[model samples]
Structures are given as C-alpha cells and as structure tokens.
Target chain A: MDTLRLASHGLSKHDQEILSKQLKMLRGRTACEWVLVDDYRSADVTLVQGQPPSDMPGIIALASTKAGKSGRYHLIEWPIRLFGLIDLLMAIELEWPARAATPLPTLSLAHRLARIRQDQWLDVAGMVAQAFQAKDEFRTTVSSFDELIERLASIDGASVRFVEGHHPLADQEAALEPYSLKAVIWSLALREEAIKSRQWHISQQQFGIATWPLFGTWETAPWMLRLAALYGRQPATLADGVELTGLRVELVAAFLHACELCELGLTVKQSTRPPRIESKLPAPESLLARLRRKLGLGYKRT
Target chain B: MISKILFIGPMGAGKTTAITAVSDSEPITTEADNLDRAQSDKATTTVALDYGEIYLDEDSSVLLYGMPGQDRFDFMWPILAEGALGAVLLLDHSHPDAVAQLDHFLEAFAALVSCGALVVGVGRVQNSQDIGVYQAHLKAKGLALPVYATDVRHKQNVLLLIETLIANAELNEILER
Candidate 1:
C-alpha cells in the first residue's frame, strides 16, 4: 500500500518498466489494485493489503473505493503501464490536428506519438531533399517551419476558430491571436534552427521511409498540418559546388535541366560580318552593244 | 518568339556538320580550340558545346544547340537542353554504342517526355537494311517515337528532320486531349 503521484506529461521508457515490475509483485492480494486518471486532480488508486491474511479467499474480503481518496487506482499482474503511456501519446496525437478526429485511448499512446513525431521530422527532411533535387523550385521552397506554418494558415481555404473556456491551451491560443496573421512564424523559425543542426541527407532518407509515395498517401484533412511539420526544416543545399572536373557533363546536364524546368530562356547574341565591295569597270553602251562590250572587256566572275 | 531545338547524339554522329548545314548565320565554335582546353591532358577529343540558329519565321527564331558527341561532355547537356521545344537525337549507324546512348538520354530525361517534348531519332543509314535495324532497336525499347534517317550535310534532309520535330509536337498536343 504505497501511493505515487505522477504527472500528466507521463512515462518515459524507464518509468513504464518500473511500473510493470511493481504490478507483478503485488498481485493476488485484494491488496493489489491500481488507479488511472487524465490528471492528478481527477482520480487516485487504493490497494489495502492483509485484509483477510490469505492469497485467494481472503483477497476477496477487502473493500475497494476507487472514487474517494484512491488517487485513480488500477490493478494489474502484467506490464500495462506501457499501454497507458501509449494511450497518453495517442491522446496527444488525436488532440493535435495531425492525427484523425478520434481520440486514441485504446492504442499505446507513446508508440503512436513517437511514430507521428518521426513521420513529421522525416517529412520536413524529404521536402528539403525535393527542393535540392528540383533546384528550379528551390527559389520558392519554404525552409522554415514557421514559414511553412504561416504559409498553411494563408492557404486559400484555411479557417481558424477559437474555442473559449478554461482550456489548457486557451492562454497559449489567446496569446497567439495577435500574431495569427503572422501565423506559425515562431514555429517556422524554430524549425529552421532544428534543420540547421540536423544531418539533412540522413534526415531525407528517414523522411522517404516515413512518408512513402507522398503524392497520394496523405489525407486531405491533415494535409496542412503535415505540410507545416515538413516545412520545419530550413532550406539547405546538398552540393554547394560541384567539381569542375569529371562532373562537367553531369553538371551541365543538371544546369540545363534546371533551366528547362524553371522555364529560363537562353540569351543569344549574333555577330555581324563586314560588308564586301565589288571592283567596277566601264559602263555598257546599248542593249546589244552593252552586252557585247561587257563581254569584250576582261571581266572575271566575282 | 525563339524556339530552341537541341541536337543530342553519340560520338561521331555528324551533329557538328548538321548545325553547319542548317544554320542561317555563321556558327559560333564552342568546340575546344587547344589541347589544354580538354582536362584529359590528351589532344584527341575535347569540345564544350556547339551553337547555331534557324529562323522559324521573321519574328520567331529556332536556335540549334548541338551537344558534344562524347559521353564525357554529357554534363553540359541539360544546360543546353533547357527550354528546347524538341530534340533531334542523332545516332551514327556505324557506332556500336549508339543504341545504349539513346537509352541513357531518354531515361535520364523521363520528365521531359511527360512535358510533351519531341525526341526525333536522326540515324545515318546508308541503306534500308540499316534503317530497319534502327527502327527495330527503338521498337524493342517500346519507344515508338518518331525516327528519321538522313544525311546531316544535305540541306533538304535537315529540313525534313525539322518538319518531323514540328509534326511530332502537334501529334503530342492532340494525344494529350
């Protein structure tokens, strides 16, 4: 009969492991019970041991009060804390716009949250990769997450609504209202900082695996949110300058391809040549006489 | 309005001569003038790119950009190929690597295919037998793209190649619908 106060931010991997060990050792005693809650203020769990002094028959004698002074109690003989952590993650994900509307209380919340975070990270990296590959579009690629977020907010049909009440995020949301038009600007700036510190190529690979066949796999509802996360990475060039040697052909080809994709026109400058002069002789006499006289003169084909 | 046309081909494919024959103005030589110009330290083969122009109309000019024959200069290809309305891929009948080079370029620029860019094969075939081989090789790759056999030096033959490009573009525009 020990009580522990846990924060809502919830378990790390080590914390889940510790709870599993505690659950198995305290089983088969009406003494064995646990509590679950959305927050500390909401619930508590209570387990009273040595009620009837027996493992099975005596275990049935203890009275359990989950609602009063129990601190959100629960009972388990297996490692279920991991599952709880997963549920927490799922809740966060579901609450966030990126995940679907349904809140995830059944699935392991931690796993889902980790997966979602990883996916967004990779997405940012992948967009950067695409920017470099499609150099023609690099000029317009959004590098910072803040910029990306702002861009999303400015998206043609985007709309934002405020839900009032004593909500956890209410203050944060209210504070952000003045900068709504500047939207995600701070987030984008933070994302840019994150990208500068990351290994972009490796990040790109991770991103590719995270979001395979990105063209059509994404849902329309989460499209803006996902894009906002992806644009988190700031713009960075993979190849600063290619060697002028052996890569000339490839470089030239790439340059030309970029120009073509960007619709750039070539500037052609034509050179003018000097005019030529013809040496002249005496004039012809008459129609017949002129021909005869011109023919008679020592004239060579010019 | 200037319409750029790129001439792409394998080594010794008469790309240079073709430009000389069709150009309205004196061709600006980009081919290497000195041995040192080539990084290879060999005097044998080195050239940057070839440039020429053909007038489509009094207002519209079609610039002919000739890519160097060697695979070594393939770097400059995309730069030269930019904004090209169509490409004339010249293949030397005698060259053993002609088919491979053709495959390389087509695969490399797959995006261009979707953009309605015309790729016309200009083969130097001495007889009908050679033409059959060229057509067969192209068909084997599932490329039913337009292919022509003509002497690059002949003015009328080059004109035919240009017409083939225009026709191919029109056909694609219709097919897209």
Candidate 2:
C-alpha cells in the first residue's frame, strides 16, 4: 500500500523520535501509513515546530498560539501528545480532497496579535473582532478576557452581563463596561460566592463550547493546565487525574477545588480507596543485599 | 555502616550522571541501547541500574543506586529502594512533563518521601519559576523536603543532593528517637 510521506522541521531529535514512534503505532489503525522523509519537497505533509516555510506543502504547524489556519495548514498546540497529533493528521488527510484548492491563508495572526502593545487594546480589539467574525473558530482563540468580551460584544444581538462585584460593570451589561481576562479568571477562582450568585452570564455560546475561552490560556496555572487538558478530554475524578497526570493527590485536589469554584469541573464519583503501590523485591546479591550486609542486617526481601 | 541512597526520576533526568559525579571510585553502569527512543533522545539508557559509592568517613560509606528512569523498569524501584537510607529524586526541568514526572517518582518512592528522606534536585531549569513550581508542588503535599536547582553533571550539585538526603535521614532519626 502507498504510504503518506511526512517531513519534519525544527523539531528536536526527541520530538522527531516520538513522532516516528507514534506514526508507526498508527500504521495498522489508520488507512494512511505515515513515513518520515528527509526531503520536504517530495513529502505529502510537513510537520513544523514553529512557522512552516512559505514553499512547504501540506503544512502541520506545531505551536501554542493560534496563528495560522487553513484547510491544508493545520495547527496542533505545543506539548504535543501522540494521540492528538495522530487525530490532527487524520483530519487533514480527510479534508485534503475538499480543501485542495483554497489552501489556508498563511498570515500569522498570533504573531500580529503579540506585537500589539498594552495601550493598543481598542485597535487590537477591533482587529480581533474582525478576524473572529470572519472565522468563527477565532472566537475560541481569544487570548485575554478583554478580547473575549470584545469579541462577544461585537456579535450582533448578544447579551453579556457581569454579576455583582465580579466586574466593574457589576449587574450591568458587558457592552457598556470593559473587563480584562485576568480579572475574569481570578474572580472565577477567588470569588466563588459572587460567581454562585451569577457573577457573569452570556445568553449564547459564542465560541461553541460554554467554557471555550478557559480551555488554553496563560491565566491557567501549570497544574491547572494539565488538569484542565486531561478533564477536558474526558470526565475524571481527582484520583484519576492524579494517576493520569502524575500530579500528587493533594495538588490534584487543589486543582479540583479551583475548578469547582469556577464551575468548570464535572462532579464524578471518586474511588475512596488510596492508590495501591506495588512492591517488588530485588535480587539477594543486588545492591540492596550489599547495603543490608554492610549494616549488619540480613536481607528481608518484601 | 553503609547507608544506601537511591536516585529515581524519568528518562533523561541524569541519574547516571549524578551517580558518576559523586562516586569515589569508577561508577558501575548497566546501560543498553535505548529501544524506546521516543521516551528520550539519548542513544543509550540505564536498563538495569547505575551503582556508585562515596565514603563519609573511614568506617561509614554511602552506596548510591540509580534506578532505570523508564516506567517499564519500575518493578526495579522497590528492589533498589530496599534498605535505602534515603533518596534523591532528580528532575529534568526541561522535560515537557517535568511536574508530572516529579509526582510519579514521588509516589513511586512514597515510603522514603513520607519519612522526609527525599531531596529533589531539579536540573536544566529555565528560571527560578521552574524551581518555585516544584517547591509549591511539595508544599501542597505537606512535604518539607529540601529542593535545589542542580546540575548532576557538576560534582558540587550532586554532592549537595547527597548531603541533603543524608541530613534528612539524620534529622528523621533524631526526631524519632
């Protein structure tokens, strides 16, 4: 069977190895067999760590920011997972036949947005609103609370209100008031009482998902980011999260607490029992034995 | 008396390097060509364990054992950890899942960790924030283990981890008595 050729750009040796291994695992599962090629020109797809070359064909951009998107140029966020990458490649392959002609625009919106100074909020908001309206998916990519509110306000016939003490425009329409994304995230975490009283309410799901703005953002702490990513994929208890994400039970509980405050986490029944740690005894002549002998103790292997 | 100290972490966290750095004599390493290159970029990895030793005085010495960092060899962890005086949990701050790796090793060596016999040495930290993340993680667990930004390639840093683990073991003994 003919295989799909893939070439990598700017990825570390480790990342390339991971991609290769994941691709090999994906061979029998999917009809498309992905093979890594050193030559970019002959490859069917080019996976890049940062920006892809202008001349590159069938680009798969790996980055944290939502800078480039097209029918052909797909973006997978950094800290790439094996499953996520495979899903993206399969999507691109499926869409290739239909999107072959238009090929997505190469403009780096993330790069352009990053250059906007703090003082350029209004101007940047206008540009962001335009981009968001032009591409519905852009609504999910808003970086800040201000940008999110701005994008929401630009939508015709949308009603947005901030609850009591949550925003400066408490109990007032969001169209009339300005709020930062940081304040919103902070209020959601710290001011649970206010949030429970309906601190903020939007009439419509502007970004498809109810909490799309909160999915991947700088405001999310590292542990929270890991937890959110894992839970966002599926419903899991705190213990499940600890086991899955390799975070401590206490740390996972803290994240769960924050998610509960924000009403972001789903309530699932958790196992009451602590995770069991299996113990295996080392060989008698191993280092453990040597240490026990030196300490004037007999080996008591467990 | 010889006290055993175990070094544990994920792949590429520098267990072998840390052991080699402080060993008084040549370190004994059991390395093989890494078949799971996807887990690490290194051409070779410790399949069994890396062993080294250092003398504290004429009568007492410390045996350092570095466990294979991959999950597949996790069965060797409890074995190596048996009769251990304490542990040095090395972390590669540059790894994509550094925080998760920290939690995994901590859970794997919970016996040593709960007794305050674990010292975390985080290597390749980009900034102080990386150290802070680890510190916060331990703090959240109610653990007061000493955490230091270290480079296992350097003898001084490796010694710091060893000394910290030894100190914790001594302190635990005193408190228990």
Candidate 3:
C-alpha cells in the first residue's frame, strides 16, 4: 500500500496523539498508509488546529472558522469525527498527484464533504439492501402494483414512514401487523423521488392537489402508484390521506387537485365519523429535529 | 383585480401541465383527441383554451389561460391575450424548430412582448447553447424579457415564470404611471 507522510502545526499535543491513534486505526480499514514526518515540506498532509501554514501545499485545517477561505487546504470542523476524518484523508489521497512538484488536489473542501456524505449514504444503502434480501417473508422486488399491494398486505402491521417521520400508513399499521416490510418498500419509492428532487421536505401538503391517481404516464414514485390504486377504491380526507399515503398534506392535496383536474378523484362529503384518537405515544422525532439539536441550524422552530 | 395570464406554446410544450401544476383550482380545459399525429404524438390537444386560477393573495388572483397551439387556431391568440397581465411562452427545446417557434409566437404576442408582460420558459434544454440561441434571438429583436430553463410539470418552476411575468408587469405599470 502507498503511504502518506503527514505533519502537524498549531495542534495541541492531545490532538496530535488523537490523530496518531486515528491514523493507525484507519490504516487497517483503508488501503493508504499514514506516517508522521518531521519536515513540513516533505509531508503529504499537514493538520492545523489554528492558522494554516501559508506556504504549505497540503493543509487540512481543524477549525470551522477557516471554512470558505481561499487556501490550499481542507477544513474539518474543530471536533472531528473519526469517520469524517478518515473519509477526508481518503478523498485527499484519491485526488493527490504522484509527483511532489504537481499541484495539490483541485477538489474543494465542500466537494470532499459531499463525497464523504455520498460514501456514508452508500454504506447505509448496502445495509438496507442486505436486510431486505435476508428477509424470507418479503420479496425483494415485486412485478406488478397488485403484487406489491398484496405482498404489503400479507405483512401484518406493515407501516412505512417517509424520511420526514410522518407515517403515511400509520392508520393501516395497526391493521397490518408486519408494517416494517411495507415501510422498506415505501422507503425505496420515497428514496427514488428524494433522489430526483434532492429536497426531502416535499410532502403531499406542499405538492397540493397534484398527488392523486398515483399511477399515470407521468413519472411518479412507485409507492404513490400503490397509494393511488388503494385510493381508487375509496376516498379519504386530507388528514387521513396523509396518514394512509405517507405523503405530506400539501402533496396529497396537489394529487387530489390533479385528480379533480382530470375528473379522476370522486367528490365526497366530509366524513361524519369522529376523528380517530391519536396515539398517546409521542410522535417519532424527525432527522431534521435531531440535526437541529446537534447543529442548531441557525433557525428556531416557532 | 383578477389578472389574466396567457400560457402560449406549440403542441406538446407542456402548457396544460404547467397550468395544472400551479392552478389553485381544477383547471377547465377544452381538449380533443389529436388527429394530427404528424404534428404531435400527444393523445389530446387543446382545441379552444385551457383555464385555471391561482390566488397570489386574498385580494388578488391570476387567471391562467392556455391558448391552442396550432396556427390554424391563431384567431384565438389575441382574443385570449386581451386584458391579460402577461403571457408565459413555453418552448420545447427538444423540438427541431424551437427557435423558429419562438420567433412565430413572439410576433403573434408582439403587443405583450413589447410591453414587458412576457416571460419565456424553455423546457428540456440539455445545454446552455439552446439558451444562448434563445438569448441571441431575443437580443436581435431588441427584447429583454426574462428567459428561464424550466420544467413546467414542476410547480415551483411554473410559479417562477408566473411570478416573473407579474413582477415585470407591475414594474412596467409603475414606470408608465
């Protein structure tokens, strides 16, 4: 394996020791070897805790404040996670030139962060794939919408929640005992749409009146097609539609409006049935909420 | 006041989809089976007009009118254009004669185009060259209307075209006053 010579500047002794241990641990998992060097000029990467060495070629700053500054360096926030550091190093190695005289990697720190994120996403995707493949009760793929719905129905208590943490099939979860299987399938469909838009908060509510007749010539999520098939049998209110379809209220409203435009969705009177009692269990917190708690994304919820 | 916004485009340019995507209510469309397969492969074509309404606020709403694309029905172009806030001219970049189509529509809607009440939305463009061609064409005509790379099927993009048109119209109205 090729080795990378690393040097440090401005970092505390404690941070240098931590970096050394992390380099050793990461070496076992990744192909590149990292070695600490005495001379800054000979080092392939220079980890800096404060001001970056101006003359250095390969500088990796460990401060968030240094982010976006023009320099030949990468920035990982002060408190670095092991995985994030390893990923950043690998990114640099991939981008490094063979000759020392060559210019350093042109990939920006932001681009490296995006690459690391994509790598983590792939890891999670592999785990999800393996989990689904291991399950004998659920088929990994379904050929037809009917087959998909029938298979989903076979799984008792099958509940599929969107990335937003809203369970579109929450109402059906109790009725269907094995909802996790359905959740897996729904997640795959939601993932497909999320990939297309790269925006996760787009719900049926935001989509407004465009979410109906789920199955059409237009490119749409497969889960939506299944939801439309089910809704074709019976019409429900905006709130219940959200619960049953796992789409945001706005998106569902849009679908219903599209159906109305196409004369597809049937008009029905408001249900006289009393509102279903919400579960006493606190709603599952969203990833956004967890991220907000951790990073304080510069805004507060009203 | 309710402002009317006309959506004009050639056959299969997604005019109906754009209106339906952003319309606050169910859009009323006068569509018939397309017998002219040579012109477009779409199953249906707008014969007379397509109508939808979108409220910007409680006090004001925009009425969306989509004119029939075929030149044979050019008679309705000005009729629908009457008393309108602006026009959103959608072009299919994938079409072989898209630039020519732009010129034709620009001539048809010259009144609106001259008055700063028109915004162009070019859909399905694969590269900047297509946009450059549109820009050059508009430049040659001494028009400075906003041109957008859009997917009319997407609500936000369609809304952007409408919003730009409205903003331009308002600006022109203020200048005139």
Task: Enumerate the candidates' DockQ scores in order.
Answer: 0.02, 0.03, 0.05
Judged by lDDT against the true structure, how good is candidate 3? 0.55
Candidate 3 lDDT over residue span A72-91, tens digit each: 46776455544456556765
- Model 3 over residues B1-177: C-alpha lDDT tens digits? 466789999998999999999777899999999988777889999998899886645655668898889989998888888888789999999898999999999999988877767778888976434465786677566565556678887876776566555434433433344
The DockQ score of candidate 2 comes to 0.03
Any runs in candidate 3 off by more than 4 Å, and if so which?
Answer: A1-302, B56-60
Per-residue lDDT of B1-177 in model 1, one digit per residue for the tens? 666777777655767777788787787756554454322232333276678876544665668788776666777777766767677777776666667766777865555544435444455555333454554665465443445566788875565555445433433333344
TM-scores for all candidates: the values are 0.34, 0.38, 0.38
Q: Model 3 has how many clashing residue pairs? A: 37
> In terms of DockQ, which candidate is strongest?
3
Candidate 1 DockQ vs. native: 0.02
TM-score of chain B of 2: 0.93
- How do the residues A66-118 of candidate 2 rate in per-residue lDDT, one tens digit apiece? 43355556777565643346556655655555445433322122222222222
